[model samples]
Target: MRAAVFDRFGPPEVLHVVHVPDPRPGPGEVRVRVLAAGVQPFDVAVRAGEMPWAKIQFPQTLGQEYAGLIDAVGEGVDDFVPGDPVLGSTMLNGAAELLCVAAENVVRKPAALDFPTAAALVAASQTASGSLLELGVGEGDVLLMHAAAGSVGTVATQLARRAGATVIGTASLRNHDRLRRQGAIPVTYGQDLIQDVRDLGLQPTAALDAAGGEAIAQSVELGIPLDRIGTIVDDKAAADHGTRVVRAGRDPKRLAAVIDLAARGEVVIPVQPFPLDEIVEAHRTVESRHSDGKVVLLIAS
Candidate 1:
């Protein structure tokens, strides 16, 4: 198997592809031939040694979300057979040509959804859906979202609107139109974010922060209840503001629901594709934080 690994925690430059022995599935697990993997800010943080708990060893494998075909099923796995198309969440092993994941964690990929897009949706969809649920975003609520053009924000915006909430999303001016297309009222994220949302005559009842730094404070300034203010990116800010830090743990059921919506063209995650060997470039792109889409590594397809 070929996988993306970092020899040290420093920069995207540390990421490189290396050949390793193919992994065989253990009991209740399935081996997958990975077709694509999603690059995330989590991967960036791990690479840069910013995540204190990751405790990376030298040559650590990276990536969490993957889309692929089942190559083999291990003992006790009954739902998936060889050649089953699937997407799922894994830890530190998704960006590879072959990896093993728990069969229970795997979700079937719809025929209508391609591998790159399916990989793109895995983390963002789980995060977005769970965040909204935790924040109690629902009908008639006015929701404020930071970093609205990014992956999780993009999914969150669409999901909020579908739940009958009015969404006010913060993004760069250039991505304002993109937010608008997703049915969110767009405001530029900055010192004036509060005023910008106010000018649109919407009082935010809930807030989700995918961008860190002052987001929780700004959500507080907007008079959104602290309980309704959630931050996926800024745990410190959430702590400081006494707001919710939405870990929004991975749920395959939630991911599958969103995948079904995406298959029906009801939701879309824009993806920037890179070849598997371009792991360094993919990490660099995710680290930059300017792309209005998920960065995905196309491993074999």
Candidate 2:
């Protein structure tokens, strides 16, 4: 199997695709023939050695979310058979021609969505869904989302609106129209972010910060309750403001629910794709933090 790996932690140039021995499924696991893989900011962190807790070895694979078909099932894995289409999260081996994941962690991919689209939703869906649930965002509540043009923010904004909440999304002026289409009142993010929201006559009852660097503090300045303000990034700022650090850990059930919504045309995630051979370019795009949508690797047919 061919996988993208970095021999040493450094820049995106460190990434390269190499062929390795195929991995077979173990008990309670399923081997997938990867069709697409999502490149996330977290993957960039892992590749750059910025995430201390992530165990890295020389020539380590770098990817977290993938969509593919089950090519083999280990003994005791009866739910998924050969040729079952699935998508799910993995630790660091998603950017490969084949990967083995725990059967329980895999979610059935809906036929309504394509492989790249399914892969795009894996991390964003879980993160956005979990963040909203933790912040208790619901009907009548005004939810403030930072980085409204980002992958996680895009999903969070749409989900909050679906729950009957009024959403105020922070983004650059260029994304304002896009946010409006997502059912959010878009406001520019900057020193006057609070005033911007106030000018719109919206009071934020809860906040979700997908963008770091002062997002948590700005939410606090809006007078939103500390507990109601949640952040998936910037743990230090979250601590400083005494706000909730919504871990929004990976959950297959949560991912599946969002996937179902996407299949029904209720949730949409734009995807920017690069071929697997151009792994370095894909990494650079995610590192730039300016991608208009989720960045994904087209691993196979």
Identify the runs in model 1 with alpha carbons over 4 angstroms from their true place: none
Clashing pairs in 2: none
What is candidate 1's TM-score against the reference?
0.98
Question: Which 10 successive residues of model 1 have the least lDDT summed?
Answer: 284-293
Q: How do the predictions measure up, each by TM-score?
A: 0.98, 0.98
Estimate candidate 1's alpha-carbon lDDT, on a 0 to 1 scale.
0.92
The sequence of per-residue lDDT tens digits that candidate 1 reaches over residues 145-225 is: 999899999999999999999999999999988899999999999898878888998889999999999889999998999
Report the C-alpha displacement of residue 107, candidate 2, in angstroms. 0.5
lDDT of 2: 0.93
Candidate 1 local lDDT, residue 114: 98
Q: Could you tell me how far off, in angstroms, the CA of residue 169 lies in candidate 1 after the best superposition?
A: 0.6
